[model samples]
Target: MATQAHRTKPALGEREMIVLMALLMSLQAFGIDAMLPALGQIAGEMGADGNDRQFVIGAYFLGAGAGALFPGAFADRYGRRPVLAVSLIAYIALSIACALATDYTMLLAFRLIQGFACAGLSVVPAAIVRDHVGGDRMARLMSLIMMIFLLVPILAPAVGQGILYLAGWRAIFGMMAVMGVLVGVWAWLRLPESLTEENRQDINLFPILRNMGTALTNRGAIGYVVGSALVFGSLFGFLNSSQQLIAETFDQGENFYLIFGGAVVGMVAANFTNSRIVERFGARRVGHAALLALIAISFAQLWSASQPQQPLYQFIILMSLSMASLGFIGANFSSIAMQPFYHIAGSASSAQTALRMSTGAVLGALIGSLYDGSAKPLAVSMLSCALVALAFVLFSERGKLFGRKVPSPD
Candidate 1:
């Protein structure tokens, strides 16, 4: 395996790249968050139950995971810009189809494909960053991207709620389509190809399989990937059940976006803090500490959930704290996982994200399914995911915890 040292310098400025990457990647979150306020509207119109409603979100993740498994190899073979352009085109088309769907099944299918198209946004941006930098630099850049990316969750639900107030749920999809088109046009016009000709691989199956296998076998990479997936499961579980928890369980239907945005403040602060400190602390050290914090918070949330008629404020505080810890875990864990696979960044990113999205989606759907007019299921699943993530991190470290390894990208 060879590194990307011989490639021509990236054309885009760092700030420009960060803004572009954050915008493109936010599409996935926008798709999910913006629809949150309309889940009840979707359910009522579709004549579906609570469990079925969760699939509107889960299906997209499943498609994203499934679709993500291959595009990295394609990007490695072709180039980042072309693959991204094609995916954005597909994303726009599918989002439009989603808006026009007359039934639940059609909407679900369109969303799945839309998510599949959105996979390029997930893999390519990370690969592009890996292409330009490595080690702690990569971690810092990723954290910065995440710091900006966190704004989507903070604002998207509100946007979705506003859209719902002005129009129907279908118009939300229309808005997604418009955004996808605008992004596609911007990327086509300004985004330069990040992968160099020297690093380009042929679209051959054997090497793709071999490289993927090698990435999967790397102890550090796979460990962080799985750990991140478990942690993401907690976050996704919250997203899957949040609307009901806010609207019905807490009787705060009108205040859903405000409460949700308030919780996101903790995440925003954590991401900013991680961005400032990750280079000095190392991605693994910061992530490990955050994982511990998450476990502790999860236990506190679990205990609170066990009590009868838990105060909404108490629940919000614990949830906010958990998300705060998670903000550190997510981007750092991802940067660490991608560190060892610089040569195969595309394939590695695709595989890692595929696993993470699929696992989180499944775990979240399971937790959501267990919603029984209380928050116990969400608390139980979140605690379990956090503990499992900690276990994986410990195992990956082989008993060593806070030490930072010198990055070897050969």
Candidate 2:
């Protein structure tokens, strides 16, 4: 094996490429988040129980986690484009399956498949970026990608809400199907294969597994990925319970979507700030600082919720601040975790993504189970996850989260 020299040149223009990649990658997160307001309606329509309805969300993420593992190997062997194209095609079909389902079991099964299909779109873009840029430049590109990706959370809930008002829960799936088809066509036409034949490895499960094992063993990689996963799982917990929290606890009634949109605005603002600062400060520095902020906010929110006379406005404020920190943590954590294994970037990306989603699914389910018509479960979960993340960062970087040399792209 040969070591490649680090190169700083960007493969594509920043704005357009970032927007396209972000939009493609965000489909997975948006699919779950946007549907929050409609989860109850879907449950009723499908005759699902409370816990089973939550499974609809859980199963999708579980599928995404499982699906991510294989695509890295496939992308390494064949190329990103083919795997991506196939994934989008599967996304469209699964979305249609979701739309056509008449029972809870069918919807749950389709959602699982849809989650799996989304993995290619979600994971390949990051690997493609790693192919072109490394270190701070990589962090900047990721920040840009995340800045664009933030729009999905900003807009998707409103979009889903509008569809729900016009045609009900099933129409949300129809819209997803349309979005998938359009993105698929666009990808087929505009996106060139980033992984060239020269860079492609032979197809083999053993090698891929070996690479995944290597990634899992790397201390820095495991720390960043696991730390990030806890943070992501906290976010997942919020998504799982946001609708209920707003409607039941806050009594937001028909305005729950607007409240959700407000939280997304906080996220977008953070991403924009990250895009500007991540290059100068480095991903670890910015991410670790942001994680500390998250921990503080989480604890404050938990404390506030414990009060006897907590106001809805106060709850909203805390939720907004907590979500704002996510913008900083999400992209930077991913970039840092992917820093060490350029030789097996594809597999490393796969393992990291899998860990993030799998852990998120478990945490989300646990939080969902703890939902009690109040914000306590969400706040507690967030605080606990944030503390865990802080500990992981300390261990991963050996208490040196900042002032480290940024690795250049090879």
Candidate 3:
């Protein structure tokens, strides 16, 4: 019954595609950020160790990392829309399962499954974007996606807290389920298959591994992935510890979302700025300058925390700037890493995300577990991660820090 134009890729214009892709990518952030306000409630209800609540987030990252490894290959073999559709269905089911979980262990297991199912959100969209565009245009488009994606974290905590006040924490998961279904249905109706038949790969382990190997051997891809992973440790560490840091260390439980969202606004602003300037300045120049600024801010924060008593405003200001720096760094790093692998875009995206999430989860867990009733742990963790990330970036650039490469031709 549908017209031919309605069934083709042109049905969704560039802006429509960007919104859909951004929504697909943002589901993971919604899942994690919106659950922060409920962590305390869930831990108390299940009689879990207070210090161990970060596992809920860590488990998701781990499962997402593991789950991401296969989706790229599958998407490349089948088609992006079909893979995304199946993943969203499983994501919806797992969200419901999480809401029904009766114990801490059960909840964690369901969260892990939810994350695994959500992995397609992280992997497929990048490949789809790469299929359509590359070079500075790719950087600009990815920055736009990142800009939209950052908005979720800004509002997610408030949304979670509001739900907590209304129907309780479990209803948060219910909301996630409903979100998944809506997005899934919309995508099924409108998303065209980006992977053409001739470009599709066979669904074989050997070929998948081979593609991964090729991706790994590319110095630009590997360096950027490792750098991004280490840099991401700072973000993961913050997420793991933020709920406690605000509620306990700062004794601002009542104003948690307001304070958290305020800092995230800095990131949103930076992302917007990056999207506008990346094409003219190049991703490398923007990312490297931001990385340097982040490192300096990290060290400054660490120094301030070493004083007899650091001001709360100082900590918030520094952290906001750090997050803003990440806004510039993340999309550029990912775009640069994937720049060298258009032919194997799906596999490359999967490998990059899996490595980044898995490594970040481990480092974040370590940093979070070291929370010692002060901001020292977080500041120190950010500084250490930034240092390592800088080294990786320099290595990847062969000691050069600000040169831009032309996007590989499709």
Candidate 4:
């Protein structure tokens, strides 16, 4: 079992710590979303046929899922700082490789490596929070981190678009390479090693796998994780299709990214609200309610898409609402699932992140394959995934879906 230690002094100010953590975590999202604007350029350059272009994004998530499992154990064994340094350096190198890729296969390969390098950035900050805070405070801290994370989806595409206009798609990856290097240096200099020697676990695959097994065996944990994954899958389906949907359905070509950025505004607002409400309402209650809202909005989107007078504005409004609800669901579900596994937080986080990313990749792939120059596939997939997530949450909570006591982080 992992033991806790109280420090004589606070490590960092809450706002500064949360902001830095947010910057680290947001890199994963930036690497994925920021490139959306350049997908067409990349496709044309590499002769990518149809939806096969999505493999570029899907491969990153696949690598990230696989990558998340090892870093936590390494952090627990060596230290968070060292593991983070190595991961960031890998990310920098891979980003440069991605920028220089001459073919689709090479780009995809480097994206996978870049995704793997992001694992430490995503997992380590949360572990550091666990190393310091507990229970409701940890949940709040996570909510704060997520609020900052919410900014990536809001700004990354715009950044990518600006780069596209100035220098071209290649510059986006070049910028990412620079960002990785800077963040790595910042981490090496500023971030302390949160995992002390006494708290370190035996660094082995078997023990880590065993801890993952324990987390998987917990009904509530599994339900929350799976439910979160499905919800995330629904979002990923939309993300995978958004550029095409905007271009084809709305006849907005180069301006598609601008509209996508507009949709993310709703998500940022929702996350900011979630930061305030999560403590008072509890993660489960807020998550369950948000899932219901997501389902309803998705259904509305499906109905709207089925109509003859289906306007792009209608689709935009419904999608905005759906995305907004996602902000509420993401962090809450993760915190609820991780609450019970304080002793094995690293393995638990690895399992949950793996499940979420793998589910997103599969669902995104399915959505990408079904692209038919319309919004139907995207709407159908979103509604279906939302319904499935709602069902899982209902079953996981044994029909007590709202107002339940927040489980203490044990």
Would you estimate the TM-scores of all the predictions? 0.96, 0.95, 0.96, 0.95
Better of 2 and 3 by TM-score: 3
RMSD of 1: 2.9
Residue-level lDDT of model 3, residues 1-410, one tens digit each, is 02122133546898988888988888888889999888899889898786699888888988898888888998887778777887888888988898899999999998888787789899999999998888777888887888888889988899999999999999998998898888877787788777766677887888899998877778877887888888788789889888998899889887888878877777888888888998888889999999999999999999988878778788788888999999988888898988877878898888888888888888888888998878898999899988889998898899999996555464
What candidate 4 gets wrong by more than 4 Å, as runs, is 1-10, 407-410
lDDT of 1 at 191: 76
Model 4: per-residue Cα lDDT over 1-410, one tens digit each: 12234343336577878888888888788898988888888889899888877777888887887788777777677666777777778877888888898889988988988887778877778777777766556677787888888888878888998999899988998888888777766666566666655677897778988887877778787888888888788678777877778776788877876789787777777878888877788887788888899989888888998886579788878888988898888878888777777766676777778778877778877887788877877889888888888777777787778857565543
Clashing residue pairs in candidate 1, if any?
none
Residue 409, candidate 3: alpha-carbon lDDT = 65
Q: lDDT per prediction?
A: 0.84, 0.80, 0.85, 0.79
lDDT tens per residue, model 1, 27-54: 8889999998899999999887866888
Number of the candidate with higher TM-score, 1 or 2: 1
User: How far is 157's C-alpha from truth in model 1 (Å)?
Assistant: 0.8
Error of 1 at 340 (Å): 1.2
* Regions of candidate 1 where Cα sits further than 4 Å from its true position: 1-7, 405-410
Clashes of each: 0, 0, 0, 0
Residue 122 CA error for candidate 1 (Å)?
A: 0.8
